[model samples]
Target: MQAFDNNLTSVIKSLKSSYGLAFFNNLTLQLHQLINADYTFIAKIDKERYISQTISLVAKGKIGDNFEYSLNDTPCADVSDDSVCIYPERICQLYPNDQLLIDMKIEGYLGTPLHDSNGEVIGLIVALYESTIINSEKIVALFELFSGRISAEIEREDKEKKLTELNLSLEDKVNERTTELSSALDRLRFTQDKLIEQEKMASLGNLVAGVAHEINTPLGVAVLCGSNIEDALEKLNSKVKSNSLKKSELEHLISILNQSEKSLSFNLTRAANLVDNFKEMAVGINTDDLMSINVHLWLNSLIGSLRPMLHKKSITIELLVDKNPPNFITCPAKMSQVITNIISNSAAHAFEANDDISDHQVIISAKVCSDILSIKISDNGKGMTDEVKDNIFEPFYTTKRGEGGTGLGLSIVHNLIINNLSGKLEVESTVGQGTSFNLEFPSLI
Candidate 1:
């Protein structure tokens, strides 16, 4: 046992400073010298083909080229069959068909099968001599000691190769998934843009509809006044033809004609003003058409145009400003849009649960201090939660989801104020108290 330990320790040290193939080659050389053999070699078996391939070879202390050969009728055949085989001398005589042994003039042979971690025969180690193998038991001990080391190297290489293949497969899968996601994102963006443009066109349609709806009242009144005048004139013609017209009756007829004329003039003028206001609000809405405006007068007209919608719901909207407010420079179309959307938002969303008509009121007021014009639109109706207020300015955000609410009204207002008009908008709300929007812009644009 002591001799065996000394031999094992010396053998391990000889190959300890090397790795992989170098370690294998060094071990073969060391084994060749340690046992004083003419030839030393290590070979792996191809079980399916019944063949042996040398990984390391040595002849008389010199490393030589490795080669492959059939394992049939050779001493290595028994070794690969999981047996330690030794012929003390005349190995060629024992097996005549082993041509390599005869050519090398080999007389003795000693070999042992190498086992993997599972103890399955994988390979063999061999030493040959021209003379009888002396100290055969010592050589057997040396081979047995180091067979595990070589087997471990082979197992490690197998694991590393498998890991590399797995990594390459994983990388390919990740790249393919990334490409799929990128394509999906592009399609989603295109669809979203199309939807937004459609909504914008729908909003314009609604604007035209609101204007037409509001104008109906005054135009209907004008038609009624014209009919009244025609009826009065028919009566006057008959009275004149008969020459029975009294002075008092003639005076009353004059008064009636004058009143009908004035009423007709007033309502027609009102319809024209509504048309002008609609044209002002909707024209150049997509462009930066900047101009100066009288704060109070502009607010009053814009509110008047929006009144039909509010009055339809019995909601009253009022404008408040200093009597002599300063003129403000801004994009009239964008400012009008911002105010219109806010008032429309209040009318649709606020005052929903309130049963009192008096409580359904919106106040729009404007003022300028230190060249910054601030406009506030507030409603005395159902307000919002903190969560809703936080995301109110985000595009397509709305509490009213499905009942014909596009959720783009306030978002459009936000973009108009910030992107086009170069201004800022802020909001305040409590769940039931009400909501207020403060729109501020530089008085000089």
Candidate 2:
């Protein structure tokens, strides 16, 4: 037992290196030389089988090729099957008949049970010969030393195999998760693109409404003035033919003609103003003016730009700005885009059930408080549901379908507020009441 303990200690030290297989082979050769054995076998056992385990070896002389044995036949089978180290004496009891050994062409056998790191007997190290050795105890002790060394090597080999399997499994799981995440991102981008298109359509719809209002006013006035002038000319022609045209009537006629001319000129000017405002809002060239701009000033300007569209829909727009608007360094073109998206959204979705346009209203207000620029846009439209509100800032969420409502309007507004202006946007809404969007920007921006 003391000899076995000493051998095990040495083997444990050698097991530190990654040469478990090489160590086993070397120990097997050493045992053959030390015991002067003709045949040596290193058998690893798993469950109730020997598994035909062996390493490199030396055959002392000509021996039969077959050395295989069933778990019930071998002298050391019991020791190999145990969960702890087993001495050679206990192994002898399992193969009590010495005749059985002789039948296998072996005079004597020496086996040291091989153990794993956890000290479980996984196999055995053995030496066999055609004749019995003279010094059996000395030979048994040397065989035990070799067994201990082989046991350490086997333990290391098992751990390496397990570690390899674990690494392969981890890599497989990481790849699967990455694929799933990539697919999800692609879907999100597709949805975002769709929403952006919707936002543009909404803005276009509002522009169309403004254009109609613009054209209608001038067109209506032109028709009225043309009709009145023609009627006045006919009355004068009739008076001259009947000799009823007097000096007082002539003077009055000139005054009436002047009024008609002024009316045409005034209405034409209004029509031109409407066209210019539309052009500026829709297709104006970008400007590089970096100035300290008043938040209230831009809000008012945007509301003015959107006024014609809302007015035509009878959607009353009201503005409440602070007496002194906070100034921020900004690009007006980008700011205009943000305001346009928000106001257009309200004009498109505010009115419920095709009610009179006049009944619907949009409010634009701005104030600077606590070094923050705050702008609020509230509408008396059919308000959004909680679910709709939650996803309103998401790229493609929209309630408008066929009317060319690109869900991107609010999304763009949100991005501009946050990304460009370094700000935040929030919304509050109640179904059947209205929706209010609050935008906050750092005064510095």
Candidate 3:
């Protein structure tokens, strides 16, 4: 009962807080553990074809490939918008034609139908157990508790899919504007806001994911605290109703509420502080405001954010500068975008063909001579051709068209370096050796 209550509290909180593809994925994973089932899935029904397509599936405690199955002879076919079905044992024996059950050796089955806002049966959630299910009533209660949330999210996702398709046309229009940037200096400033928005969203996904993970702890605590307060209040109410309420029990409830209040406040404040960090990232790069920046500190901070993305690819980033690095006055955000673009570009394109793990390295070294702050970002991976290097900074001149690459990263970096930061950008490459990008900007901007 205690475990189920905690799990129920967590499921409700997670369902409320999550969005996007992650929403379904997390729910399926959680349900797999929560129900202690061998296979758990959330599926979208195709009533026309009598099929169910698993959007999120977990099998044997691991993420499994999504597939479609006919509901013609399966137990899932029996579930209606208002009907839930559970077979505690010998499900395969009952449904002799259900090949999936026989193949997977599934004995127990619990399926709850999902309904949209209009109360139409759109999908279902299924939990399959290899062993006999001992708690059918509990499973039914759990499914009943979350079926609405699941249905709403599925409906929301469908709407979002439509909106995303519509938004693609707007994105195309925005991409068209990017073509005019290199031709017009005035136009560059005008369209830069949109460009920065697109670019920041691309490079910052990993950062957002990391922060989301960090924020989850505090958010979970706050949710747990709120649950505790509700339970305490329930106990107090029950005692009052029975005329068994004592002064000590009332005082204990007060103490519980006080502790919960403190925990909720502290954890929520912590989550808010983590969110505040992202607000700094939301600052527009089009601003010409120059701020004093310690070169090494700024670079380290930028690299720290990129580390997660790099580490995923088994790549290493080395900051080859001393502790007493020079301080400069440059637009920090623009500088960040510049560095971010370069690192992002290198991360995506540089190490593609290199089979050697040890060779997957990006070296960033900076030094100040006179009033010029010169920085070099070099990648020890597959180098580019002279022709490719020449046109890399050109607008919309991408080598990765079919692979979702805009070819705008280097162009943005180029424009920011020359027009925004009063800097010179240069690139050098040898086919087999490596590629190097040198950025020289004014130190006292």
lDDT by residue (tens digit), candidate 1, 67-103 = 9999899889889999998787989999899999999
Q: Distance (Å) between predicted and true CA of 64, model 1? A: 11
Q: How do these models rank on TM-score, best leading? A: 1, 2, 3
Error of 3 at 202 (Å): 2.1
List residue ranges in candidate 2 displaced over 4 A. Answer: 1-19, 37-156, 223-260, 283-301, 304-314, 321-329, 344-351, 354-360, 366-374, 379-411, 423-445
RMSD of each: 5.9, 8.3, 39.2
Q: lDDT tens digits, residues 1-445, model 3? A: 8987898788778877798568888888887888899999989999988899999999988889999999888899988434689899999999999998999999999999999988899999899999999998888788777788888888998999889988998898888787666568777666766665687677667556656666788999999999999999999999999999999999999999999999999999988866664444434544667777777766765676677677666788999876776677777778888888888877788777446646689999998777678899998877899899889988778888988787788888888888878899889888777889999998645
Give per-model TM-scores. Answer: 0.70, 0.59, 0.43
User: Which residue pairs collide in model 2, if any?
Assistant: 195-408, 198-406, 199-406, 314-357, 350-381
- Give the deviation of candidate 1 from the true structure as CA RMSD: 5.9
What is the C-alpha local distance difference test score of each model?
0.83, 0.68, 0.83
Error of 1 at 394 (Å): 4.7
Task: Find the number of clashing residue pairs for candidate 2.
Answer: 5
Which prediction has more favorable TM-score, 1 or 3?
1
lDDT of 2 at 355: 76
